[model samples]
Target: MNTLKQGDAVPNFTAKDEQGNTISLSDYKGKKLVVFFYPKASTPGCTVEACNLRDNYEVLQDQGYELLGVSADSAKRQANFKNKYEFPFPLLADEDKTVINAFGVWGPKKFMGKEYEGIHRMTFLINEKGVVERVIEKVKTKDHAAQILA
Candidate 1:
């Protein structure tokens, strides 16, 4: 996977969120954003990461960051996960890999001694101008907010 790196410009794209609302990168112009990509919605690890963000949503916003979650799940599934967790952010339902591929997060993944192609759990911190300021590949699901804050 050709993962995006710090200092790179995040590709402009639009996709549907859990509410079937169209969201675009352009909408976040002039605002710092935290875009996190997870393997799936409602899964164990994914839940921790999302909940961590949700739990600290206010602090993150106070620090000038808007959060967004992305995954290759359908809108219905994403909605369920968000509703269940009461996440304070929007979760993009990237069923067609539009945002996933643009960020280069989909590639080979190994699990249970088997290898398969899947979405890599990653997060990108973008500055106000849309340039990636940080890329967190080794995400600490439970302490993700700390990682981002740090």
Candidate 2:
């Protein structure tokens, strides 16, 4: 798989949202997209990052950016998280890691002195033209929204 870089066209993907609604990248061709990949739903770090996005959602909208979160979680879990936090954005259930692998965010990670392979908390800022504008690799879970907004 090719690692995407700035100016590279984001790989097109279709995923089911928490509500089981199918969302395709092509559907948002003319809008800026902030697509973030997290490890799981309802986990500590993931929850904080998601809530941060919720708290800053208004500002993000004001800036004309659309947010979409992805994880190798089930639709049920995503729905529960969305309902619990009242997130204003959709979270895609990438149960098979299709989107995660396509974006090169699925790889080795170190946790508690152990090495394992999983989604590396990462965010991609895609431009209106579908090209990657920037990548946030060293994401801070608690201040994720601020990191992206910065």
Candidate 3:
């Protein structure tokens, strides 16, 4: 996959969140945004990563960042995951891979010595102008917030 890198401009795409609410890239204009893409909802690794962010949500906002989570999960699944975790951020139910393809996170991946296509866990730090300032590919599931804020 031709993943988006630092200095790239994020596509102004619209998608539905776990609450089935329409969300768009333009909605976060004039504010720093954290767009994090995960493989699935409620998975072990994904859960840890998301919960880490949730636990540090206040610190993230204090630093002027709005968080958005994305996964190729159904709305119901996304809803359940968010509700269970009580995450303050919205989780995009990108079932069609629209946002995933736009961010170029869907590609080959390996797990347990097996290789296959999947959504790569990634986080993008975008500036107020919507241009990516940093791309964190080596995400630490338990210390993701530290990675982002670092």
Candidate 4:
């Protein structure tokens, strides 16, 4: 996949969140945003990454970062994951891959030698002007918050 790189302008995407409320990149205008894309909702690695952000939600906010999680799961599954973990951020149910394709994270992935097309786990740090300030492709799921902060 030709994933987005630093300094790229993020596409203004509108998608339904876990609660079915429409969210757009414009909603985060004038604020620094952390848009994390994971493969699935409530999966092992995805959980760790999301929980790490949840555990550091306050610190991230203190540093002026608003977090948004994205996955190609259905709205019902997204809702379960959010409620089960009590995540403080909205998890986009990108069932149509609108946001996922906009970010260019949907591509081939391999697990145990089985290759399949899936969403790549990555994070983008966007500046107030909707430009990507950083792209963390090799995410440290256990220490993701620190990775972003670093």
lDDT of 3 by residue, 12-102 (tens): 9899999889999999999999999999899999999999999999999999999999999999999999999999999999999999999
**What lDDT does each candidate get?**
0.97, 0.90, 0.97, 0.96
Q: Which residue ranges in model 2 land beyond 4 Å of their true spot?
A: none
Write down the worst ten-residue block by lDDT for model 3: 2-11
**Span of ten consecutive residues with least summed lDDT in model 1:** 40-49
List the pairs of residues colliding in candidate 2: none
Please report the candidate that would top TM-score against the real structure: 1
Q: Tens digit of lDDT per residue, candidate 1, span 68-89?
A: 9999999999999999999989
Task: Look at candidate 1 and tell me the lDDT of residue 114.
Answer: 100
Cα RMSD, each candidate: 0.4, 1.2, 0.6, 0.6
Higher-ranked by TM-score: 1 or 2: 1
1-150 per-residue lDDT for model 2 (tens digits): 345778888889899999999998998899999999899999999999999999999988888899999999999999999999999999999998878877888887799999988888889999999999999988898888788889
Tens digit of per-residue lDDT, candidate 4, span 7-116: 99998999999999999999999999999999989899999999999999999999999999999999999999999999999999999999999999999889999999
Give TM per candidate.
0.99, 0.95, 0.98, 0.99
Model 2 backbone overlap count: 0
Higher-ranked by TM-score: 1 or 3: 1
Runs of candidate 1 with Cα error greater than 4 angstroms are: none
